[model samples]
Target: MNKVILIGRLTKDPELNFAAGSGTAVTRFSLAVTRPFKKDETDFINCIAFGKTGETIAQYLTKGRQLAVTGSIRTGSYDAKDGTKRYTTDVVVDSFEFIGSGNNGGAGRDQNSYNNGYGSSNTGSDYSNSSSNFGGMNFEEDMTPVDDGDMPF
Candidate 1:
């Protein structure tokens, strides 16, 4: 019942590490998932994957790459050293897929290139370590303003 499926681009490259016990592989990353709106807002979700899925992702997935992840939502609570109770929750990914282009500014360009091994677009910028030039694809500017009167009471 706590299942969640998400398709989004990684904010950065996944941090892959090995657990102390059994040397199990663990991959942690954040995903920028947008809602169905024209505005430039996104929900950044914390994700973790273990075992083979984590290994595969760590090997092939890169920063800004689009992906589809299926996982279960988990919640936990702990006490801080300052005598405060903290609640934390995240999605535990079990499976995932390599979707389309990188979330870089040049989206469709990479999608066609990476998918077909031929890049036809003229992206003068490279996104090896960054996705800065999504070609003026400023997500924030695309948002539509909400009328003040539309506020729910």
Candidate 2:
């Protein structure tokens, strides 16, 4: 029940780091989600992803690129250098997808034409491929059809 789903744009490039003791990869970023009914307001949410997901996000995602994420809310507190207690709320990203038409502020392209063989290397495009790449979730290909005869509703 502690789930959160959000579609938004990256406020900046994801910062990838490693755990001090375990050396596990961790990436942190902020998402700017627009308010549903407000035109000029946005919510800045902090998000974190671990392992290969974090590495992929840091490698492919950039600032201002639209993204969709499913995760859970997590809260933590730490003592600051100034002796003040600092609190943080973050979305521990379980899955994410790249949005837009691959033309994310012209950051998806390089001087060369090929974009790591993903898709068109045009700098004008924000995403390269047609499929929405996702992380942290394994999609099964052999899904059985549900029967409506056993419906409880």
Candidate 3:
């Protein structure tokens, strides 16, 4: 049950690199998420994406672009150059979605269901209004207006 979802703006451009020997793509970036209570306050969250997900994020996303990510929190400690143990915490991205339109910032597009295929599978469970047919079914097509008089609860 160690899952977290965040929707925020990119603080800066993502940094992409490959792991040694394995050559796995690794992208690191920060998200500026506004606090719920304080509209003026924001928290910069560190995020890391691996493999194809990392490459896609680094290539398509840019600074100030709104993004929604689903992942788990990871924490680690390392010896710093100043002879002190430094602790670090980051969100290990499992999947991501392009939120706002354009490279920088703008109004959100109708198709926010764009997934960057990190931990996705062909389970046929995805349902959306987007043009992309990842799942066979589009739940939007089967929707009907609910009447107040039909309430059973």
- Minimal lDDT window, size 10, model 2: 110-119
The best candidate by TM-score is: 3
Q: Judged by TM-score relative to the true structure, which candidate is superior, 1 or 3? A: 3
For each candidate, what is the lDDT? 0.61, 0.64, 0.68
Query: What TM-score, over all chains together, does every model reach?
Result: 0.63, 0.68, 0.72
Candidate 3 on 100-119: residue-level lDDT in tens? 45454433343444344444
Q: Which residue segments of model 1 deviate by more than 4 Å? A: 103-153
**Candidate 1 positional error at 12, Å:** 1.1
Quick one: RMSD of model 1?
A: 11.4
- TM-score sort, best first: 3, 2, 1
After TM-score superposition, what is the CA distance of residue 122 in candidate 1 from its true location, in Å?
A: 36
Cα RMSD, each candidate:
11.4, 13.0, 10.1
Mark the 10 consecutive residues where model 1 has the least summed lDDT: 111-120
- Cα shift from native, residue 44, model 3 (Å): 0.3
Candidate 2: which stretches are off by over 4 Å?
Answer: 102-153
